[model samples]
Target: MAPPVSESPPVETLDLWLLEAAMELPTPLHMLVEPNPHIALNMADDPRLSREELCERLSLLAERGLIRVHALPDGLQELFSPEEISSAIDARQSRTPFGYSLTDAGGAIWEHHARPDWSRFVNAGQEPSADEAQDAWVIEAASLEAADAEFHFHESLGDVHQPVGESKHGEVLTPWQVTYWKTLPHGYRLRYVTVPRPADPARSRSVPSRPPWYTRVWL
Candidate 1:
């Protein structure tokens, strides 16, 4: 018997392009928000980056399913919100918040992308301009090496720990971080990476955002 024709649609060309864009920005914001968005995205120090630079990186994040451009307030009802998308501004005036970060879907992406070290940050500033969320990813990746030693000392560790997006509802798989954690008790870890293949295309980590720990090749 022959293999059945797969119904899965071909990967959206635009999505692939966007993923590439996300990789390019690799701004490094995840470190701030991962454990808690309000505390990180809102409270951290501050820095600056240009719109052109941000737009390019954000484009990739959008493609990676990390973030979306649809305009709507946050809430379950908003998921289905409807609006007219004009080519002129892409509805900029109405956009809920025109910026960058992992979309609600990013929860799952973090699930997959995160390792025990996903929570750390490097020399990143507390605050960043334009794509604040995008920049977090980089800080989050770099801090891994540094935080591993001092994190346990923090008060936050004493409480029942859980990832920012996770809830009592249990493990959730979201589009933002397409990857899920492999180990539960051991802290965030990668669930899978395009499974190993002989000379398969390497795993693509957003540049600068991924950091040095992800040294393995072939995604």
Candidate 2:
């Protein structure tokens, strides 16, 4: 007989964009006090995600208290913007009426965490501003060389094994350094440029075409 199925491990990461929307409510605070559809419409902009996926995220956000939800009531459409009210009206037709609004804790989290981290994930391939450059730390290249001693590359996987966004060469940053990097302003993505090999390839520290040690980070 086949072995019984093991339970899945607990999820450690939430959807980053979903979390961002929950924390940043574009509309007025008063409208939020009473649940309305305005916030979800504003927050969920990813065309790739279907409305069902967006609803699932909304439910998750509600459970976390980043947003509050309420059952739809008659004539409550007055509270929402034209777009929100229209969506709510359509939802009513399907008997799946619900609304959500950001909570105080959500706003606090936006101010402290999400807003600061927003720049890191969004803007790639641009140079960092002067203020952002100050936040970077220059780590010795030797440490990364040691880390890359066990490096293996699988060309077939393409970007699957690669970092989600731009990365600082073969060496990964320490967790605190990563957090600091996230707090930097937008347009600054960390990546390593390939340094040309010297006349004596044997003396070069960088690996052939795939250098594990990054000499510098282009902010």
Candidate 3:
């Protein structure tokens, strides 16, 4: 028998554009679907929809709990910033298009069922107050080794890199990472951690990105 659909909360609803965006995501990394091809097949170089439409689509996606959107990280932006028009074109061509990712519930719904009014899937989670948000243990790179000791890999939503049975520290840090780290000047090394957001565990918020469960790489 098919498993029953999980109950959805009041907040988990999706409009058509939001549904399309969720479906189009290649992975849970904010993939830029702004010039959504499906919406405008050969429509134009720019978004066929007006700015209001685009903004509304993005807003509805977030408000309905299908995806999380945030400003591009400054460091990452600088790394990708183009030096010239040609460079800009090259960077855009090569870059992993990033923008928004489906929440846990969004993933499940996307995989198991036809597109739904995603807002229907909201979790009846209590909104965390300033105090609770303050108290949440956001891990820092320096503390990764210590934190790994306390939580089993599966216990915490945040442990993105630690894997099972790969090493004493239990992460399958990729082979390239060793050479990459060695090349860096002394006193710096790669740190594996999740992007911190205030957790609204009950409802859909950005779930932490992790390496594939089958093979792990520390980011």
Question: TM-scores of all models?
Answer: 0.27, 0.27, 0.27
| Candidate 2 clash figure, as a count | 0
Order the numbered candidates by lDDT, best leading.
2, 3, 1
Clash count (model 1, backbone only): 39
Measured with C-alpha atoms, the lDDT of residue 166 in candidate 2 is 32
Where is the poorest 10-residue window by lDDT in model 1?
A: 188-197
Off by over 4 Å in 2: 1-16, 19-47, 71-89, 92-98, 116-219
Least accurate 10 contiguous residues by lDDT in model 3 = 176-185
Off by over 4 Å in 1: 1-7, 20-69, 72-83, 87-90, 95-124, 127-219
Question: For residues 1-219, could you state the per-residue lDDT of candidate 3 as single tens digits?
Answer: 223334454323333324434443322222233346443422212334554444565555455555554322212331111122113222334434334445555544443444333211111111233553222222111133433533333234432222232222222223211111111111111222222355445433334543221111111
Writing each residue's lDDT as its tens digit, candidate 1 over 24-80 gives 132232321234432343322222223343344445445545565433332222111
The CA lDDT at 18 in model 1 is: 32
What TM-score does prediction 1 earn? 0.27
lDDT of each: 0.29, 0.34, 0.33
> What TM-score does model 3 achieve against the real structure?
0.27
Per-model root-mean-square deviation over C-alphas: 16.5, 16.6, 19.2
